[model samples]
Target: MVSRVELFALIRRDARVEGLSVRALADRHGVHRRTVRQALGSAVPPPRKTPARSSPVTGPLREAMDEILRADLDAPRKQRHTAHRIWERLVDEHDAEIAYRTVSKYVARRRPEILLEARNRAGVMDGFVPQTHLPGQDAEVDFAEVWVNVGGVDTKCFLFTLRMSFSGKAIHRVYSSQGQEAFFAGHVAAFTELGGVPAGEIRYDNLSSAVRRVCFGRSRVETEKWVLFKSAYGVTSFYCMPGKEGAHEKGGVEGEGGRFRRRWFVPVPKIADISGLAGINDRLAAADHAEDARHIDQRTATIGQDFALEAPLLAALPVDEFDIALTTTPRVDRYARITVRQALYSVPARLIGQTVRAKLDAEELVVLHGSAEVARHPRLTTKGGQHLVLDHYLEVLAGKPGALRGATALVHARQKGWFTATHDAFWAAARAKHGDQAGTRLLIEVLLLHRRMAHAHVIAGIRVTLEAGSVSPDVVAIEARKHAAAAGSTAGDVEVEPPGPQRSRSKVVSLPERRRDSDLPPDSRPAPSVAAYDQLLSNTPKKGNAS
Candidate 1:
């Protein structure tokens, strides 16, 4: 393979310098005489390394992949994957039947594929060389596979990422599930990570993310939104003909993605919280931009070094980030709440029965009834769970007893075991003595103790007394000697018990009287219509009912 310019030069050198005929020039170059003549007249030099058919042998994997490809050959190229990429995607996305290496070997053995990458033109390889970068002129984008366990179910998810070819900077964001929105959002986020849009061009595999039509030699079939997107950023998009051994197209970001997954996303990555995981990702992307890599562009020292040169040419940031976040239409249900993956989020009474958008990210959920942001909460991933909050739905508990069980986003209160088993026992004992309202108040006290020590220690101390059937969180607090900042060790495994079982029996001492039903407040909003409470004698803590 020779560049057209090279072919022309071959003829030129032979015809004028070496006294060779045009036919002889074509013979030496393995090109037609006309091609040789055409190359001679071209003003632009021919591309280096004219691509060629890579396949040499075929086997079972080849046969299998061929059948899959053959079935969809005429439909479109973008819709059907090229051989090499299809190989990677099969194993990466679907856990296909064969190894990716096998798919790659088989595709390479076929020489020319009608899918995956574009076909190479013969003779272009004779004197071909790759193009040099021009500062902020080009960027490459790619996808990486990440494994995550959302709740108890383990599954693989795709991460969309972008790497500036000149600067080495990359930006990435996760998708709960990948489809068009996730793919589009990745592009938006990558640009944001780069601080602005690159002025040159961005390269991508004709991923379903960017293209819909896959015509041969017709490499320009692109989606409307993507066309508009690139046009807005003021950059050109180039495509390789499908079924070609043309790794050179998006090679920069392609290799970058693999390097990044191995260095930053792999080995062992654990996150108890989603936001923390995102923070680590952002840090890694920023680090890649600053560290110089082995390959250096012509003008700039390295990709990171070149980024400074290119930054000035990129598009300006918009007023708001593309809320690439997903939103779902749901109504806060009858219980004054909206349910997410089984965990319920309480919205206000005014929004009840009205449809709202549950704008969701990997870590948080925001409920909006149209334009107004009504409520926000951490999104849960499991089914059949309760994250009930008393304050968010306090309107439901007015004048009712035992109606409120959960503390509000009191995770803010720095409370330990706000609704754990020990809390349950203490509540039971308190209700036996002072009624559910008193039990709720006692629950608040244990949480407040967290200001002095870790919540677990507070709960451990609570259990020591509450487990013995006691209502005095204060007495329990005193017995545990947690009067001051606890001297307990910080080891996560430490065991601390709540106060004593020393009982006060026999001659009854006076205690504060419990409120009667008529004593219920009159000014609060009426609760959701429901069954009435058991209204009976409640003037004092019933010692007979005491635990």
Candidate 2:
């Protein structure tokens, strides 16, 4: 159809500019001559009339569909009657022989109107106003699940995020699991990195780590440790509503987790260990300072600038940091190992049959006997896992030499490079000479030397003994002492007297020292002779054989 303005312009152009008649204009523009006359008589074109059409399929079903849709006003939001449901009802309930598509078209057209009317009746609001946050007043904390390649294994890791509400500054750390220890450790680390805790309140969802039980509405039974943590930081805790309804309460961190993951962890970070992950976090924190262009309080200011302003307003850090380790008293088994979180860690053999306190942290398991820390191991994630230190079981292994050959502890020791090929070579030679049991026993004795001697010296001793073709424990000990003394002398840590006649020497070295029989290095004094003791014994009185 031609527009009114265009038709009027065309008629005027033909009549005045071209000097064409109304009939010619009508013929050229493909219109009736009377219509062309009307256009020439007045600038306005006549309105087009609507043609009446019959609706066979939807004509009868329109009212029924509208009624069904209108009835949805009282139904639950999720269970509201859909257009397809209306179509099914029309066929099944009303026996109407209309095409489903025809019903779909009519229902789709009318459903919006029905919903509008329903909304008007219900008096529901459609949107929320943007909220303004005060500096150092609030922060939000949340965890997001991300996949990270740890030690060549693709594992699910928890990315903990704490976002300041005012400046939008955030701290992100990844952990192997979202356990209570990791949760607490994340907060401690984030607070330390941020330099302070929010002075007013820290908002969180109903995380299991914080909330022990959810009561009606916003009431909660908080976990005792979480309460202590908040107290230690001198910050109050606020919980968002449950589920999706409460998501907006901690919206800052909720969005931060996604944004950070997309920006930094897009390709799934391949980290070698937790320390590597911590390094990544450090880099991310440094990069966050450069993101200063983001807006705060409707003004163009850097997040770093806002954070600087808010930093002084935050609460001071406590003098003592909260211990985020999970403490337990586990009894040391006969193997001198304590079970913690389904993983076995070895303590000193002397602690066997005693209950020692085990502090299980995010990355380490520390075993304490009374006040002293007896053992520490990298916290294991696998169930039924064992982390053993060969030194911890050396005494036991020495007593039972047969157990040393195929011991699981020995396997772990070899895997860690603590037990080297030198140790194996020494053990094999000793066993060849002294027989299996005695040779293995001798190897265990050499292993015990690690306690008093430096590891490098022990290794050197092993090499020296192996080269000398003697697998004697005493010989290894002598070699170890010699190596230790040589190293100390070379490093200028020990003084050796120059060789001279014993009578000419100004100082008299003790018998034990001169003979090197007191475990001192041979260089301390001249080697002693037993010939003098034999002569003295022979010269002594022999009453029965007196001549």
Candidate 3:
């Protein structure tokens, strides 16, 4: 089908080329004579005119609608009248008949004009100015929620993004939570990745991790730790205005988080544990580096090229790194556990009833006895959560074997895969041969072997003893040492000490040996000639006959 403009072109062309009369042109084009005359008058088609239509129902209600919309200027923005509400009011209060669609079309056209008039009267200006950032001068920081499959379970994670404003270069880190420690850890990680901090102020929202209180105007009450951290790094913080009003102040990072999540976390990354985040973060760093070669928006240079100009301008890192871990001294209870941030973490059993130093960081808790590290566990996210290490209670278990069965540390070990099925099998066999108490004690002795030997070696030793129908921990220790020695040398035989006096002296049966003939490679040489030896014997036999 031809458009109006096309139809007009066709009409004018036919009249010009064919020399057809206006009546014939109209008949050929299937149009009116007036249309052909108009086409002949001008090459362009005239705009279609819409005739004014009278609305008897809404004509009188216009005044009422205007009054309602005008009254909305003083009302709260959310509570103001809508088009439908205005129509309903007209129907209920004035007994006026008006279509909702008519009211809606009128309101849509008139409301913007009312707002413009009001803004002009109030002398208010609403517009955005183009922003320019100097190299390494400005950056934005923000946190966004990311979902990941951890241990086959969907888990919520917090993603921290720090983007350079000038180059659009960004560094990101993921955490279990957005707490103060995690916030500090993110900054540390980003700084390490970027190789320096921004010389100018970094923009941020009113996150509690940095600001203790959001004060009037731009003044903010910063947390004590945040102040110290800034001093350590020589950083300047620029807090954006509260809520959506300040969102545009740091638009770079606000958009970067979404882009990164969509780019990398689209499949909902799966990790066996929180430690898997290190691998994810490594991949993200590579991705960041790869992006440096790509352009951002209409920029002439690639991001990496721009970053090269900015990288050198950044402030140098401090000579001494800041220790971001929170230090606390907690007394160990009778259970040999220290409570830190409302979470229970096991230390050595000997530390019970004693005070120990605990350092809590974003990802882990380290317990210290004097200058030496005694215990370490992954940080707990929830209140009243407990992390127990089985080795911490080994000494206690040795004294009271009954406690091994019901020990919370043992349960935790099983959950963590630290305790294997081989251990359980050996324990059951030992308990059957020796009584429960003696067998459990023997298992505790074997468990102690892990401290001196590798875990796999100890497990192999247990298997060797169990196969030989021996329930002795000493035999397991001897076999475990043999495994350790065998691992050290592959081409030579391993020497193992004999079992202790308490163990049975019976020689353990061994597998059938290989044949000697089969052990040697095939020899291609013929049988050695004995002709020379025969000649010597004949020469000596004549002397024997004379004698």
Candidate 4:
């Protein structure tokens, strides 16, 4: 093959400069006359073309392989068939004698095309209409999973984000789970932070907390609680289509979740619990003002400026905030524990067989017996875990003092610093003096004193009693009362003395006179001086030297 430049040079030289005929140049160069004429006509060479070939093994099965791959588009992700599985199915079910690699190659090549065609048929496209939002008119809500280092333990946490579409402002909160209580609480917090509710509509996917049943298109059978919440706030809600088809509806919140995480939680916030997370969210909320540079309305104005314009358009807050707690009646078990959401919490042993109303929220579990709250526990995140308060079991332990030695409640108390080193020292001394059961009974009595006195007073009393080497419960009680009285006085507990009758004339009373050395008692008297006798001896002695 001759280069284009060389062909052009030869053609020009022979045809134009040397006056060579096209037939003469073609014969001399052993080339076709048409080629020489084309070269002479133009300097550019024609591109090479290759003939197409069909694979004997895979060509016949192309249609069947394509159908199999296309059917996978509707199958569950985990249940979808792989290329190797497809090959096995072809050999076993279809009696095709094709090699596995040939089928695999064809499936790999055609699977993406088949999936693309399926999406196209389903109306999933790249085309999106730019949205225009009115002030306080719309908001998008979504939850994203993020990794958090909580108390040195790495775990996945759900970040609930509500983004106002008009202002591009968002509220990001962290929760242990994406349960209904957390969902409701997130909304309450976001609304409170924004100072009002979005008036037009709040958009959400078919989250189970909101939608009890997803109907055709955007219609939904919403949960009863969700409906009540919507009514309470006087706001409307719009459900997006389920799954990937509806992601665009809440795209604002989805993007905000990512942006906020990258900007604030990039270091993977190290928090102890939900309260710590709340503190971080408060800081993030304040820092959001710095995002004023973010443009809204396609660079027409900044988000902060737009937000200022929209803040006034929001609906006034409701008279009262919603109580985002799940109320349930749970029977306390023999262990004096009630199971709420698979977590066990203790109540008084007397309520062991009773059913108590348990109000559970994101952070606390409050057990109420009729009108009175009997037990309160920090909500547990781990499933099947137990949170026991030693005080709740103290009454039962008093009866069975033997159980106090290695009880779970005792361990939990020690871990929580409720049972301090002073308590341990007192218990040890009591056990050494009395028998184990008797000593433990005494310790239980001391522990019961914590009900009346403050923990600090009880601890101080224990230290005082230990120093006095009196480990008796009576001594501890006395010391605790004295400490409590002192604390009360120091804390400004004042008592006014009654006013007495006015006496203008005062009585003159004299104090006892001071006694001389001679009038003092024998044991208290001072010794006489010997300085004069020593001076006489110095003048009379020195016998050896004076003689």
TM-score of each: 0.50, 0.69, 0.75, 0.75
Error of 2 at 536 (Å): 11
The runs of at least 3 residues in candidate 1 whose Cα sits more than 4 Å from the true structure, single-residue gaps closed, are 1-129, 148-155, 173-175, 179-185, 205-248, 293-300, 319-322, 326-329, 335-351, 361-363, 369-374, 377-418, 428-547
Candidate 2: list runs displaced more than 4 Å: 1-128, 266-299, 473-547
Reference-based lDDT, residue 179, model 1: 51
Q: What local lDDT score does residue 407 receive in model 1, on the 0 to 100 scale? A: 38
- Candidate number of the best TM-score: 4
lDDT of 3 by residue, 1-547 (tens): 9999999999988888999999999999999999999999998999999999997877787777777877898897789998888888888999876678988999998888887888889897778788999999888999999998988988888999989999999888888878889899999988988889999989999999999998899999999999999999989999999866698899889888998899889889898877687788788788888878888889899988999999999999989989989999999999999998888999999999999999988888899999999998888877998999999999999889999998998998897787999999989998998989999999999888887777888898888898888878888877777666556522123354553344433344444422234665666889889777887776665645775
lDDT by residue for model 1 (151-203), tens: 33344556677777656666766655455566666777677667787777677
Q: How badly does each model clash, as a count of residue pairs?
A: 40, 1, 1, 0
In candidate 2, what are the lDDT values of residues 489-519, reduced to their tens digit?
A: 3212323344334332122234655675666
Cα lDDT listed for each candidate: 0.61, 0.81, 0.86, 0.81
When summed lDDT is taken over every stretch of 10 residues in candidate 3, the lowest stretch is 489-498
Q: List the residue pairs that clash in candidate 2.
A: 292-302
Report the error of model 1 at residue 373, Å.
4.5
Which ten residues in a row are the worst by lDDT in model 2? 499-508
Name the lDDT of candidate 1. Answer: 0.61
What ranking of all candidate models by TM-score puts the best one first? Answer: 4, 3, 2, 1
Sort by lDDT, best first: what order? 3, 4, 2, 1
